[model samples]
Structures are given as structure tokens and as C-alpha cells.
Target: MEGSCKMKRRLLMFTLVICSFFIAGVVSADEDILLQQLIEETPTGGILELEDKTYTGNIAISKPITIIGKEGTSIEGGGTGNVIEIRSDGVTLDTLAISGSGMSRSSQEEHSGVRVMANDAILTNLTITNSFHGIFLNKSKNTRMSNITVVGHGANQLGTQGNGIHIMRSSENYIDNSYLEKTRDGIYVEYSHNNFIDNNTMTDTRYGLHYMYSNYNSFKENNFIKNVGGAAIMHSDHIHLEDNKFSFNQGSRSFGLLIQTSRDIHVLNNEFHLNQRGLYLEQSTSNRIEGNDFFQNEIGIELWTSSTSHVFIKNHFNKNKVHALTVGGESNNDWFENGVGNYWNMPLLDLNQDGIGDDPLEYSSSLSELVEENELAYLFLASPAITIYEKANDLLTQHKVMAFDKYPIMSERKPINVASVGVGIILAGVGVYVYRRRALR
Candidate 1:
């Protein structure tokens, strides 16, 4: 019995020894594997903690993983293909700098620092440079990209360099607190919707923000400064732009904001300064433009005739060479709504001590001179020379009236609005709202 027991104990000891050897061999093999090979071997939902070293090679991740890079850790592509290709959902990448993707002349082969084909990915604090595209998302959704800095090749040539953050057919993404410069477009979204882009600074790009065929999006508190073109919203609708600063975006063809073929847009409390045109609306309809500051622009607002049902109220049009102009549209726009109109830097009188003007202000055109010297033309009779010049010019030129602001405010509406003083007080609520929004952000 004692001998049999000893033999069984030896067999148990032999099994344990083999198990120990197998575990030690697995650990050593894992330590010897390269990062690329390690990623390939890791299963789904693994967390990879990278050391502070450079990993050179193109890495493709097809499983959900959290890659946490230590400071000074980088992934370089060696100038070929995409640096990191993510094909799985719920991937999180943080604290890494990626660069050196191959530049291709063809748009189809455009190389990117990171290409995301997954949903619900989070990319934070990444620095991307020297690539065709900084980050490209294809059919991604619910992605959170924040604190990312992208420096492109500084090429504004179309189809050569891609956007800083490009979203194609993605929706419900949150991109905030990011900076992008020197790319084709800073943030370009196509066929994307329900996205929130807030507090982003984009400069020196072709378009600071460009959207096409996207709708129901809101971009607020963004600074689009010193760009070739500020922003272009084309073929979209139901967009809300609030409290944005469009500054120093000046060129002959460039403007602070361009709205084309869009409808139901709300542009409120925005600061448009030092641009060629503050607001250019082409074929856009039913837009409400209120409480905006249009200062130092060559043209404050230009409304093309294709735009209809526009409501311009309580906006300050000051120090612009041309406060407002309209072309090729019937004067069917509501210049004044709810007895409140815009504040113009024109000669106005409120002799009755009321804050509002006594006479209905006329946004005069060359066609106003066509009103002949008769009892019906009583307003022009106050200035006989003006009336005579209008009559003579009308007889000579025969130009028709374009637009009229019948209730122009007599005083400049303060950015801080006071809703009710006597009659037609500009609402100070919007100013307070704007101030609070900026402060909270």
C-alpha cells in the first residue's frame, strides 16, 4: 500500500511540472512577440497598454480593443497605406501620435493617419500629422472625438489632401474641443446628421466647416478664423448656428457664412466681423436671422431672390459698407416681424421721446425716386432735393425697388437687449443667453 501511494504521488508531481513548463513558455513567448503580432493574437475586448516607445508598422485591428499609449509612444506607417485601420466597434485610442501615411494622387486611395470603420469609438488626445487625412470615418456612429489635434500637409488643393476630420455617412457624433489647421477642409461631413460640433477652432483651411446633404445638425460656439472660406452649408436644412465667431475670413469670393439651397435655418446671436460678406443667402428660404452683429464687413447681408420668407429682426447692421442688398428676388421677405425690425446706422428721428421711430423707416432703393411729387408722396416732400434727385434718377434709369424695411429702429439696439421699454424694444434676453452660453462653454 505504501509503495502504491508513492507511485501515485510521483505521477501527480510529474503533471504539475509539465503544467509549470507550459505556463512559463507561454509567458516568455508573449514577451517576445512584436506589437503588431501581439495585436493580431489578442482576442476581442482586450486592453493594450503600450510603453513609451515608437512602434513602426501599419497596424490593423479587427477586434474591439482599448489601446492606451504612454506619453511619447507613436505609431508610424513608414509612408505606406493607413497608419492604423480599425475595423471593429467600441475601440478606444488615446495618448498617441500617428503619422507618415503614403500620399496618393487618387482620392480613392487616399491614405489616412487613422481609418475608422467602426461604431462607438472614442479617440482622445491624438496628434495626427503628415498624412492625406488626419482621421477618416466611414459609416461610423456615436463616436466621440475630442482634444484631437490634426496638422495636415498645408495643401488647399482639392482632392490632394483630405479633411482634418472627415465623416462620411456617419451620425450622432460629438466632436468638440479640437483644433485643425492647414487642410482641405477642417471638418467635412457628408450625409451625416444629428451631430454636435462645439468649441472647435479651425483656421487656414479651404472651408472651416463644410457640410453637404446633411441636416438637423447644430454647430455652436466655434471659432472659424483666418480661413480661405468660413463655412458653407449646402443642400441641408433645419440647421442651428448660434454664438459662433466668424472673424477675419476675408476674400473677394469668400464670406463668413454661406447658406445655399437650405431652409429653416436659425442664425442667432452670431458675431460676424471682418469678412467680405457676413451672411450670404442663396436659394435659402424660411430662415430666421436675429440679434446678430454684422460689423466691419464689406457686405453685411446679401439675399438672393431665390430666398423667400426670411425674417430679419433685432440685428445690428453697423459699420458695413453695404448694410444689406438684395438681387433678383421679389421684396416678399419680412424685414420686420412682430413690430420689431433691425437697427440701421441711418438718419432716423424719434422726436416724440419714444425709443421707436415716429415715421416708418424706409429702406430706400433707386426706385423710391419714382414716387412723383404729389400728396401721396408725403415722406419724400420733407427733403425736396432728395425728392427731385429721385425723380430725375428714376426718369433716367427706370430702376425698380428691391427691398424695404418699413420699421427700422431709430437707436442702435444694444447687444444686451431690453425687451420692453415703450414699444419695440429689442429683446435683451438673447444677449443674456449668448453671454451665458459663452461663459458656460
Candidate 2:
């Protein structure tokens, strides 16, 4: 009788498990179909509010509409294609957690968490992960995306991972207040122009921001840290970069900012620190690199031969191992305009108190000469022997000047941040009040 009872119990447990599996399958299928049905039933220009639950992906919006999601709403791809595809203009997607885009099934094709091919769309408050491409804008115009957080495949798989935000042939768009990490490039823009990117943070990617064949884009107030390259502006013209921070981008051939084959770029009031190279220019012309700060970099500025017609004024170079290394960069560039040149963290005689150095800054180095003559010397860079040699050469040799900066500014004037001061004073007052209360107690 005991054996019979045990067998019956085992049969009952197996049946329950089977029933649960069958019910789960049914529910998943039902939800997917119901979601599609609901979307189909919703009229154009209507709103489809999603529940705080997971929904199967491969959804497409072909009409002008808005989709609002609850706090925990998610759309997960079925590992076949993009999670969401927007095809019509005036669409809006907000407050959605999206992930699991299909892997590259072909060499020429890949999927994205959200693919926007429409114009005048607004996407906000999104959290996306495991995205092949987190968000893709293809020929989209006047689109705005803000408060987006994306995490891509690991950087170690860079060769296979797609970009965090890919904009191709898209123009006149805005991306603000976004955070992206571990993608191929944090925000890759190609043939996209008149875009505004502000107040974004990108890290652990190939580049925090990348531009190729794009023009008239503004990148401002962005934080780029721990990427291979903080930003790479290449083959673009008439771009503006201002008030950005690039830091801790340390690796081979890495730079806080790299401008290559670009022209008419305005790099102003930016900070570059703790990088392999602070600012690198290659084959670029007619750019304004002014009011910037370079600190704690291996090389503050590196100019290749073909880059010319640049203006460098009111910038500060401090605590860098080498201030500027030029390889045939006798650009006849204007280092001083309006009686003002850059401030170098070096000793200079400012006798007249006019805030100008009596002696001009002649950036010529035996180390630079050696690297130019033999590129292999760069491999031994930062070695103690190399450092010793460089110091000895600087002390002993008559170096040939590679670049010159006349009317060098001997002073650095930093603007006071009022908000920071106010915050500090409030914090101090609160601390004192707490101390007094504790003493009374």
C-alpha cells in the first residue's frame, strides 16, 4: 500500500508539471497575439499604453501613433529581428525597457532594439540592453531622443557588437541626456548633419562620439570617459564641439579627441585629461582649437604634417609629459591672435606684467625628432630609459624648433562656477548646524 501511494504521488507531480508548462506556453502565445490585435485595433494617432509586463517583440508601427509603457514594461525580441520598428512619422515611444535584438544573421544585415526610419519622432525614458544596435536612425529627420540608457554587448566583443546609437544619413536631430556604455561606438554618426548632442555620458566604447562625413553638428556638454577614443571627428566639416570633458582614454593610439581629415571644426572650452594623447590632429585644416584645457596626458597636442591653418589660443596645457609634439606641423597657424596665446605650464619671464611671456614658446624636442625619424621609437615611449634620454637631450642638445607660439600668455584665468560655490556654502552651513545640535545633545 505504501508503494502504491508513492507511485500515485509521483504521477500527480508529473501531471502538474506538464500542466504548468502547457499553461505557460499558452499564455505567452496568447499575450503575443493579443498585443498585435490591440495594436491593429488602435486607430491612427491613438495611444497604446502597455502594461508593466514583458511582451514579445518584432513589433512594427506603420502609422502615426504614440505608445506609452508602464514603469516595468519591456519588449523582448524573439531573437529574429529588431524589437521595435517605426516606419511612420510623428510616432512617439516612451518609458519602455527594450532588449534582446537579434544577432547579425548575415554580414550585411543586423538588428536593433529600436529602429527609427521615421521623422519627427520622440523617444524618451528608455532602458535598453543586449542591443545589437541600441537605437538606429536611418534617414530620420527632426527626431528627438532624451533620457535614454543603453548597454550593449561587451567591449571585448567589439568586432561583433554594434553601435549604441547609430545615425546614418539622418539630419537635424537631437540627442540629449543619454547614457551609453560598452558599444562599438557610443554614438556613431555617418552622413548625419545638423544634429545636436548634449549632456550625454558615454564610456567603455570604441569612441564616445564618432563622426564620419557629417557636418554642422554640435556636440556640447558631454562626458566621455574610459573609451578607446573619447571622440573621433573624421572627414567632416563645420562641426562645433564645446564644453565637453574627455578623460581616462588610455590605450595604444588612443586620444581624448582625434580630428582627422576634417576642416572648419570649432573645439572650444573642452577639457582633456589622463589620456594617451589629449588632442590629435591628422590631415585636418582650418580648425579653431581654443579655450581648451589639457592636463595629465602623455602628449597634450599632436599635429601631423598635413594638418594646417589652425588657430590655438587661450588654451591651457598643464601637467602633461610633453606639451606639444608636431611632425612637420609648421602650419603657420595662429598661436597668438589679439595679443593672446595659450598658457603653458612652464617657466616664462613676464617682466612687463602685460600677461605675456617675454620669450616665445618654441616646441621642439629631440624625442619628437626621434619618433618622426623612426616610428618604432614610439613603442618604447614612457620607458625610464626613454625618459632619461629625452631629459638628457633636452638639457644638452640644440633642438630644431618644430612649432612656435609667439606672444604666449603667462597667466591662466579660470571662470568661477557660482553654482558650485553656492552648493559648497550650503553644505558647510548644514554641517555646522549638525555639529552644534550634536554638542547640545
Candidate that would win on lDDT: 2
lDDT of 2 at 92: 90
Give the poorly placed runs of model 1, Cα more than 4 Å off. Answer: 1-33, 41-43, 107-109, 155-159, 351-354, 364-403, 412-441
- lDDT string, candidate 2, 163-199, tens digits: 8899999999999999999999999999999999999
lDDT (0 to 1) per candidate:
0.80, 0.86
TM-score of each: 0.78, 0.84
Clash number by candidate, in order: 2, 0
Residues 1-441 of candidate 1: C-alpha lDDT, one tens digit per residue = 999999999999999999975543221112535767867655567667677777876888888877888789888888879999889889889999899887886646678899989899999999999888899988999999999999876744656788899988999999999999999999999999999999999998989999899999999999999887888999999999999999988754578999999999999999999887788888888999988999987667877778889999888888775567665545468877666688887777767554555566655444223332232432332344644665676678654544466666777744222344523433566677889999999
Write down the lDDT that model 1 would get. Answer: 0.80
